[model samples]
Target chain A: MSDMSRPGVIHDLGYRHYDGLREGTPAIARTLFVTGLRHVYGLGRSGKSKVMPFLLLAMSVLPALIVVGVVVLTGLDSLPVSYADYTNQTQLLVSLFAAAQAPVLFSRDLRHRSIVLYLARPLSAPVFAVMRWLSLTVALWLFMAVPTLMLFIGAMLSGLDKSDQVTQLLKAVVLQTLLALLIAGITGLISSVSLRRGFAVVGSVMALIVLTGVVTAVQAIAAEQDADSASTTAGLFSPWSLYSGLANAWDAGIDTFVPVDGAWAVAYALVALLLAAACLLALVARFRKVGSR
Target chain B: MAVVTGERTGQAPVITTAGLTKHYGSVHALTDLTVDVGEGVTGLVGANGAGKSTLIKILLGLLEPTGGHARVLGHDIEHESQEIRRLVGYMPEHDCLPPDVSASDFVVHMARMSGLGASAARERSADVLRHVGLDEERYRPMGGYSTGMKQRAKLAQALAHDPRLVFLDEPTNGLDPAARNDMLRLVERIGSDFGIAVLVTSHLLGELEQVSDHVIVLDGGHLLRSSATGDFLQRTGSLLVEVVGTETERDRLGEALAQRGLVCRPRGAMVAIDPPPSELAQEGAAHDLIRDVAAELGLGLMRLQPDRGHLEDVFLDGAPRV
Candidate 1:
């Protein structure tokens, strides 16, 4: 006897062909920047990954909140805390944030050897490096700017004089942006070279914190010994001192952590620009050779 | 089937390298190697450190060659790498997936990087993941996946963009025998059914013989051999004849074939006959003689075929010891 014939079926899972517009390098860089920004704050990662960044962010905003509270309660016309000096006061927290988070943006890809996947796309190494640097720079800017924005909002709510306060706050925000770029460039460079997370975190923290401490000590001893040039040069070694020197040079009214004045101001500005450019160049070079081996 | 052979009548070469050399300081990773890869599944067979990965990287434009020039899909490797990368996909040999990301998210991100729009990336990622047989498990973190699942995830990402060409670097690296066979079948389907050119690498010589339309062997950073898979296993001028029943039946056939002035020997349940002398080179002479001998002996001829070469023979003969 013949067997019974069965009906056949075909499934349509909507696997459509994509004939849409394909973006080029700029769109790719933008996508990478957005993804990296989310990664920096642990947005797509596990819950455990969110703790450190949130904690550090809260810590950064605490002092600003307290200042704003005092201004609101006492009904002061002017903020007790100068906006420009807030970054200096909270430099440790900003440095810590950069140290802890730069690896999340830069090192993890290399450690997991995922850089190959990235480079295999229609992206170049230099573009990848620049996008990563820009993402961290923007993240750091937001990290510092949010608290400063809070202070501005508090002053406005308390009915402080509009023109002068806004002017000063705007200048402080500019200075903070510069400081953010400086920190991101240096920390991102260090993290790019150290693929191990623990090692990269330690290296970034030490480079930003320990080196600044040593430079500060040397500046202090040099100033006491009446060594003017030595103290000025000492201030050039650490990102914190460099930002402080630039602020002083720009006449921001914030107290300089180290004595940077006269011709030293131009020197400090030149050195900071050169240092940022150098770190960026190094990062590009590192990524260029990333998967070649 | 109209297979797309890169060097065949109408198809052009998919990849071409001329005098390609790479040096890592004192270590020469790839010597002056020149080769052409046609369409279809082309297997790249070599031992470990035989420059298989190096060649793939160079072809993908991920690594710069110290010497020589190359092109992929008509794009120059040196000047037009962006164009090359835009058209090709790569599945690296190492463990490259992030531990925290799900396979779906990662594949979608890869598709986006390949210039797909947001909606297209998501849709393509789903399609490729399903094609690679990663079901609901694709939504879980890749760090928790087994080795075979990870390989499938890598393959899905490589296909996420619907590339015209793909360089799969050891897709079956850690797979068991069954998984390995499945991966090979998928590779063959990619080349034949999907019409995408594939350059897959493996150290296991025999495994690729079944799937690859063409095989290229490399040894010590040099091109050892390149040819069609059938050419690599072409007939070796001998015939294998099997008869039904036990050794007695096979022996009777062998003895009768010998008595017919044809040299033959028992091989398991079959008899092997070497090529006859030049005087017996006339068409159908050897065939008719064997048929007549078997008929005279009343033997049941079960099978008759030419002895074919194997990939292992090529590897054993040409591959240098590591």
Candidate 2:
């Protein structure tokens, strides 16, 4: 050890003030971005993601293969719906991908209290909210996009193209991607607010599947009661109805079958985006209050 | 700024809070707590659910208080928490480490997040790991480590950033006696050698008596006492004099003191004297009387000091014993 009495040693001279860089906006954002990457990668020394990407692909393709096998064996193509039409439905893609993957997106952090470590750092709650939502949205997007693309390509390679198949496939893929983003954003937001992963997952799924279905059923009953103004009655809440109206307006009537947009889809997207933003704001508020302690 | 620069003789307290109260629904975690923790090792002693973790969490900017305000290193906890977090390091009470990552990599990442450059972060992580006595085990994933090793790893990460102030909650919570002693020595070194301001908490008050310069005792959620360790250990105006002899010699000395009308009690080879204040006014008469009594009994005086209770007495009746 060096001399204790000098009081002028190179490093041990005295208590040095840490004249370091101030933690500003960029610093906070960089911390959040790194945390987002860590969330994607999971907590492992070997740099392997705890939640595997291939598992989601497997889940998606397993159902698709079963559907194709049933269609080929039973000669169900004689019905009005062809194999291509059945394969290119947004609802099937959404339910399959979302049913397995959406829970893990934001639920893990809340359950583990890993979010506390992030809030203790430079990242504020709002930044954490946006980053987590974006990370999950991207994760779910990749999980859904690749399998759907494979299905489309495989359908084209097969001998079942009726000229409008290409347009239909493109519409199906685009709409499914948008749907995944919207659903993942809303689910991730809802999941972040809760501490129990199971509760968060169940609550989010109920909000999306049960609540929306109830609203549509109520609107349909109202429309039947007022048959004189069926158009006005259907104006309330129907994502499928809204999309069908929009598709009918377009060259093809993809929306005629899909019915995910009109006034309802706009309202759904807007309300989802607003709820997502509100969740983000609540997260910020939570962090600010915690950090102020 | 004005308060920080004022002319004060003692080292500045890194954390000061007044009337700091925090309630969760009907349960109060901290109630009307006003404490000033100075530089060096200050131990916050209390049992579980006695507000030790709550206090540390509040200091680290992880929980908001229901009432009152506090400052850490002259920064308002409400407005300048990000700044305070940068300056102060915190070691939490629980096992929050990611079990799959090696201590070295995780600590380095934590350091870099605190604004250290890549090379500096790596170097500091290595140094702190060593300082906390982690050898080759530092490279192993925390999942396989024992509880003692995990606590060391946690402490290493808290110090990786070279923070000037550190809040260590139950640093020796689950350690063996030997390991607890080692951890306490390391904590003492952090305050005395590295010159880092330390606020350590423990459920056992005796564990902190030798390490802490000042002690703040909390009970149920209220501040029971906040003072220097010596204040709690002050003499009750009674002297415990030990003589080198048999119990008869001690009894004889006690009998002689009682003959002189000085209240004396026999305690093994010692006699505890309760000298009257009027004797103190006789200008060194109390010292002379004790010397004469020991000489007359032909017994060697081994020790003489004003009687003071042990640190454990503070928690005996659940109030300030002093």
Candidate 3:
């Protein structure tokens, strides 16, 4: 089908100036947010980077899938585990995901000195810090949302009450978002500060996993010793305990070692919000200082 | 051969700084200095710790000057760094690429960071990569690239945004001889063919002689000289004579030339004569005298050549004397 007689000519169009619409900070932030989200899940990166995130993801989802299977085959009236309780049960896997993936978004650029490339007119240090935080928060929320969705679908398939399942699933979604925001702040702050992958991962694991474990153990001991206020106060020390305390207070079918009450519950919410805000402010300051020579 | 550089479309000097000073504790990284960089390829030449990198970072607005005023493309550096960032791109002196990403991905990301949309970022990344001669190798991860390829990738990202000006910080560092030549040629094309103004830095003064239209010499955080490249390579107005013998013959020739009237001295294996005396100022008078002196001494004269100045001469005795 080719014209054999005609000679092929390659035209050299010289370098042309760009005259198109150049977006501003919003567009730059959007692009960074999308890229950061994809990179955390190892979507746009090297093949080897996909292993740890996907492995952690699979491990987190497996228990929900098994729960769904059991409810479907036995034709139970309702699922054995509540949706809000699912994330708390998978806390170890969730903590590992945050620890393993935060470095991909935060530490690698600073460690490799590639963060300088992102400092342009539209993408300043503050905007970069906030967009990266948003990406990690959204990624974490999605990590919890998937299993909850599966449970909702499984419950619906087995003829559970639609309104009741929706209410509990909605509560779980809200709690997951709150939990994600706090954890993202902690991990992003740790990774940005460490600037070394191994140290960043270990620091995040200590903050999100080890610190939370200690808080939970202390809260359980306080509750066993008939100290209600101390147990409730200990739950405010970690992101995971705060999520569970709020869940139990809201009647989301989560049973905490000590029940969170009126003023203490308000303190828990305020601490979570203020701590996340403090982390973000610290990130902005860190980025601004690091951007200079 | 000199490259045919394009006009700068009638703009101010690409960069200007006045009384710029930077100090850390007691160490002065950049002292009270002032300079202006015009269009085309203006080479910032200095030795190590000569403040070349310090100057570039300050111009990019990434470092604050303790006291000074600077402007890039008419944008104030202190208050209007955002505007300067929009108009200029900087290829840093150190490694700025991650090992896991390919050149294509990284350039596209940088272009997007510069506010280009997705499709525009991709298109410009491809064009700039091909322009830097990384056509087929751009798809591989930069970790596997040679030093030359890494330099090219760095340049590609700087060019992807279509800025009016770019600052290249030691673009030929860590490159082999041939690769250095290639990189120089690419820097020239960015200025001449693409009509982009470039401010490139190098510690090697000789390398910029072939590509730079204007040269600025920095010595110990001070401005030694700033002028056109031709001025630094002018003829020294001295003639050198060599004989086909040992140092003894060269010394004898030098002594004989000096004994006669010409003020001559020994320069390595040659006898260097300052411009001949007024009485013997005829064009070839020095040549004839050197020839007769060598023949009479039973030494074969090998070469009689005029001495030319080099950019390196600026450092040897300081350009201030020159």
Candidate 4:
């Protein structure tokens, strides 16, 4: 009976066939989607351990918002006010939004070596790259979108309206969301290439805030030195500077100090898009190399 | 490609790899490894960083080799890894249990991922888990499990998919001795009872002597030796002799044997001697020499026997002394 019991158990598992490759496109796509969803829910349902930088972001912006609010609330009529001025302050919020969301979205998988588990099943590197980038871009857009909308509401209600008020407000929110996604995607791609999460985050923040700022300052000086030439907006190739150009466009004119328009803005978006794609492809290539090793 | 439904028809090995090499930058994890593992239980013995894990990973298609190729169950591992993964069961070297998932749920999910239907997956998972000795505790989160239970859970997951080839990578790594024995026995049954091809790896070489049909020794990511278990334990032609009467009698017998020009060494109460090959030609003379030597010194012969090499000796010789 003991012998009988033994074979009975082995027989029950039946048989498995794994000699042939599974090449069905539908099956591959389904597996990729399911795995991507698993990653999304895995991070989201990781409970309260999900690092919420919203609080830290609010604290950082609170001081600047208070300064703006004090002047507005006290009816300080002599204080400077315009849509362009509001856009500049909101630019700080955009930078803060980029700083908060990019690291958590990109670096968490690499930090945990969870990429090994994810890639081992069925998904390859390119599918993984596209899925993860889309997940992060969508999550970042949501995180940055709702708050920016609320701020837009607050701005509109703050007794500021012109003939192009509605169009400008809608355009501002749409451009801000697109710009946030572009920045998040670029940073996410960059961060995935780095080994440590903290270093990646620090590097991305510096790239967005410092390097891009320096480039835009250099361009501004160049445009001033050669006033005859079209405004030197070449620095807009950086996503942060590209968004700055978007704000300039929203103002219906350049800051004069930093002229931008015509083919220059298109060239900026083209370069940023190309860099974002190239970084994404590099991320895919990196994963293949790491996993193959 | 058509699925070959029954057992393998040819005498070809289930796994064969040639010139398998893996390098982690400058560190050669596996170097110039060539092995052909037949059906049944084969034990891979090595110390840490001895390339046991690297070979297993290469076989499982989780790693791509730098120099060579491995075929599992007649499938090319480099080009057809997904298929290899489907046919082979792999228990990883590390503790990688998802904390929130129960053992049963995780194993069932794995079975399904290997292409089982819902009912088959559930039924197989339960049966495999039960066979592994996990009880109601299996329903609990694996995060709180003891090392033995966790090891069993990992083993169960590997078997749940009904794989033809299973790579048990240090399955008994953290288990207590009893648990280790149980896991080893389970591994033995997987080969003998189920007709599965099992390649189990361990740093502890001697423990696999009884269960393994073949033993493969790996050192510094290279194959040192591979042989049948019996071949590993064959006699080495030396014999141990022990005579009991009095301590003086035993020593005098030893002295007399040495005076006779026999090469003998005092080993505890027993004096071991290497029999002259000419004396070995006649069994009676060899026996008489031992008895005569003891009697000449008025010692009573208690025991005299040929020394058979043990699996430990094989490992000792093959293992890197450093």
Write down the RMSD of all candidates, one decimal each: 4.0, 7.2, 4.2, 8.0
Candidate order, TM-score descending: 1, 3, 2, 4
List model 3 lDDT by residue over A2-97, tens digit each.
Answer: 555667954567788888988877777888899999999999888898999889888888898998999999999988999999999999999999
True-structure lDDT of candidate 1:
0.86
Model 1 chain A TM-score equals: 0.92
Off by over 4 Å in 1: A1-16, A225-228, B1-7, B25-28, B243-269, B291-301, B316-322
Ten-residue segment with the worst summed lDDT in candidate 1 chain B? B1-10
DockQ (model 4, Cα): 0.11
Worst 10 residues of 4 chain B by lDDT: B1-10
Binned by DockQ into CAPRI classes (incorrect, acceptable, medium, high), candidate 1 is: medium
Worst 10 residues of 2 chain B by lDDT: B1-10
Encode model 1's per-residue lDDT on B99-147: one tens digit a residue. Answer: 8889999999999999998998998999899888899999999999999
Best by lDDT: 3
Looking at model 3 chain B, which ten-residue stretch has the lowest summed lDDT?
B1-10
Q: Give the alpha carbon lDDT tens digit for every residue of A209-252 in model 4.
A: 77777766776777778852334555654676666575565563
Clashes of each: 2, 10, 0, 0
lDDT of 2 at B303: 90
TM values, all candidates: 0.91, 0.73, 0.90, 0.68
Candidate 4 reference-contact recovery? 0.08
